[model samples]
Target: MRSHLLNDTTAEQYRRSVTEGVERVAAKIAATERPFTGVTVDALAPRIDGIDLDQPLYDTTAVLDELEEVYFRDAIYFHHPRYLAHLNCPVVIPAVLGEAVLSAVNSSLDTWDQSAGGTLIERKLIDWTTARIGLGPAADGVFTSGGTQSNLQALLLAREEAKPGRDGLEGPASLARLRIFASEVSHFSVKKSAKLLGLGEDAVVSVPVDTDKRMQTLALARELERCVTAGLIPMAVVATAGTTDFGSIDPLPEIAELCERYGTWMHVDAAYGCGLLASVRHRDRIDGIERADSVTVDYHKSFFQPVSSSAVLVRDAATLRHATYHAEYLNPRRMVQERIPNQVDKSLQTTRRFDALKLWMTLRTMGADGIGRLFDEVCDLAAEGWRLLAADPRFDVVVEPSLSTLVFRCIPAAVTDPAEIDRANLYARKALFASGDAVVAGTKVGARQYLKFTLLNPETTTDDIAAVLDLIAGHAEQYLGESLDRAS
Candidate 1:
């Protein structure tokens, strides 16, 4: 056990074990032919369940060999060029190396003592992100596990700020009257945050979106007025810079104005669109993001970093006080007086991982412009995909992508039944998944099933998009034929 520990005495053992593990994973990646094996739970679960955790494999190689049967074989390989499903990006080598170093060090990011340079690195990264979003000099933030946490923290601050009379929303009576405004297509996190904050499900007022799937500013303004007229407090207006299904960015500048007029907090959930901040050609797409009182960015989604790398930034650094708590032994009040920078002061979490190191390494290795080019490639690929879908007679595209996602559905000309068309599209996605050839996401646009291509891999080319479309069409056509046979 001591030999396995990563101490100076066991440095050689640590190097050997980690190197073996890395090589094993590298080999599996190199050999993976598809994004996944389309593995079924029934088949794989039994193998995992059969493992006896009480028994230990004395050797690392033996443990890795055992892992091959359960974990590695069927794992989804996002690095594959054909992996067009979801917002999972192919991580850069630099980020992966950073992951290795950080995991070995295992620094807790909550306090300065636990993470010395780590705290500063995270602050620097937060500063870099806020600067990119034009959050101004007084802006400050802390890294979160992901977008959901970031959104939650942002809304929590909004709730606190909405409290009036210096005592704050003062009581539960005021909490009951608080409301959040968001577009119908905004991330579900907005509503989830409302619930976690003790607001009712109805607290999230769903404003309508325009033809491009963007939140209609007029509708948002009307909602804000209605809330005030009814004596309800408009806590916050969540403006999504990139909707998951359609990649539609709401009208940010207009939303910001509405928030100001209503004296509400404006939060831009740019988890998906934050990549545009690094984009060489498309930075102007999210022009009004700067006006947000708080912004949520998921580097995992767009910056090609690993999972769990995200930040919630604010225009006023003081607003983070809503999440702050001073512990006697941890972040004591005296620490603030001492001018110590503590990440736990701004985070909802305690004892968080040093996830900022990955982004730091990525920036140091490739620079932001390198990330911009990678993100731009994916966005460009999505445009080409949209063109292909628009030209194809068999599919209907919902909207042009604002980032790197395309939502479209296969509509068979022979099928007049909308429900049947929906079934064909659904069947195509499932069959393709079961076959382990390609993976795509499914969503409903106006109660109709649609196939989605969330292009996050830069290596995924236009030709791959065309190929996936052909596969989807074939599966859909096959399903239509099967339905006809069954009907006959």
Candidate 2:
């Protein structure tokens, strides 16, 4: 038996390894800061092929070296200003250091025995997050992989709440003719969760969105009425705090009111936009988020944590008991008598990471205002981008700027056919990425294709956006045979 493995690695060893790793990663990040093009992939692949899988893996040094080469080298640099493709962004220093510490400790946060102090840390964070959402001190939640798992877990709770005394999710009566309400523009994760929860995809009712892309509250009421008339139990209404395609916020307070009136659970999937909680400028948009029965927020998206740090908060603490199970020896007698809330009682996973430390470190070091400023800065930059696009005859912004993301299409004057506009937007977005000048994504809004930019980095500026726009315009002029004067 290895003495190091038995006693756990020493603090000095951990410190030395982490410091070295951090420096290496930082240098790698700096070197690959620019938008990577085709040449590097071909150059790097040949070296990767030289690796022998049959070799015995022994030391952490070799493991870290390989990771630095393949994983870190190939990974997209979200910190790069030109990589404005998705919600992902550069992580903060505090959280990065916190991950180092947490990995050194190697705590399994599933149970009290496994986690110890880690259990307390995670619980406190959950309590703090619950309080932020207007949930009472009695409310509880567990960190999840991301918003999807959190959403799935929320639906699972709803299922259990709807069907009491059921052996499993079987029988027509046990299933409870259930239906969920969400905006037509809301994430498909809701539909996926519904199906996984045995409600079937048909059970997710797509409520209409107004011209602003917000879920129409009146339309939701009508849909709830229709479901009730059809003898279906209205399980829940999901409101998007920040929708995926367009960062549109559904009328959360209004949706909460309807949920209250109809006696249905309200689950807010604020995965992308929940970081606005830190921002005073945009917090009002998610006003009634506190009233939600459950809420999903991803620290990975907004808090600048690494991937897989997400949370699901429920308004009632006792509600978590719905997912509880007991394995005699593991959580037996005295352990259960101690009344410690085993994290496994609530989570979907058995060996969960100590993700709370990252957020805790971030909040502790940066203070609330620091993170809030990042959120505000991103939203402000997005609005600036929207304003730029609106003023320019070359582009058409889909909706008013809501959060960090803005969707717009490049419309040339001579192109009356919406088809041509869509084609131009698609080509322009692709052309910008392919040229390695700048990066932005594309999405469809009501049959029209539009370029999408989701800016999460506070360092990204209006100037950066303008450069991308110019590239987009140049792409249109080159490919679509449209002159600058013809750009609508």
Per-model lDDT: 0.92, 0.83
lDDT of 2 by residue, 1-488 (tens): 25245245565665666677777878887787566452355767877788888884576677788887777756667888778888897899999889877887789898898889899989988888888778876789999999999999998887777666334545854464888889998888998998787776588989999888999999999999998798777888999999998889998888888898888989999999888878866778788898899999998998788887999999987788777777775655466678975888888887899999999999999987788888888889988988999899988888887888988877777668787777777888776765666678888887888888999988889999998888887787565685444775
Q: lDDT per residue, candidate 1, 346-465, as tens digits?
A: 999999999999999999999999999999999998999999999999899999888888999998888899999999999999999998899999999989899999999988888899
Whole-model lDDT, candidate 1? 0.92
What C-alpha RMSD separates each model from the true structure?
Answer: 1.1, 3.6
The list of candidate 2 runs beyond 4 A from truth reads: 1-17, 38-50, 56-74, 164-176, 482-488
- For TM-score, the strongest prediction is 1
Superposed by TM-score, candidate 2 places the C-alpha of residue 187 at a distance from the truth, in angstroms, of: 1.3
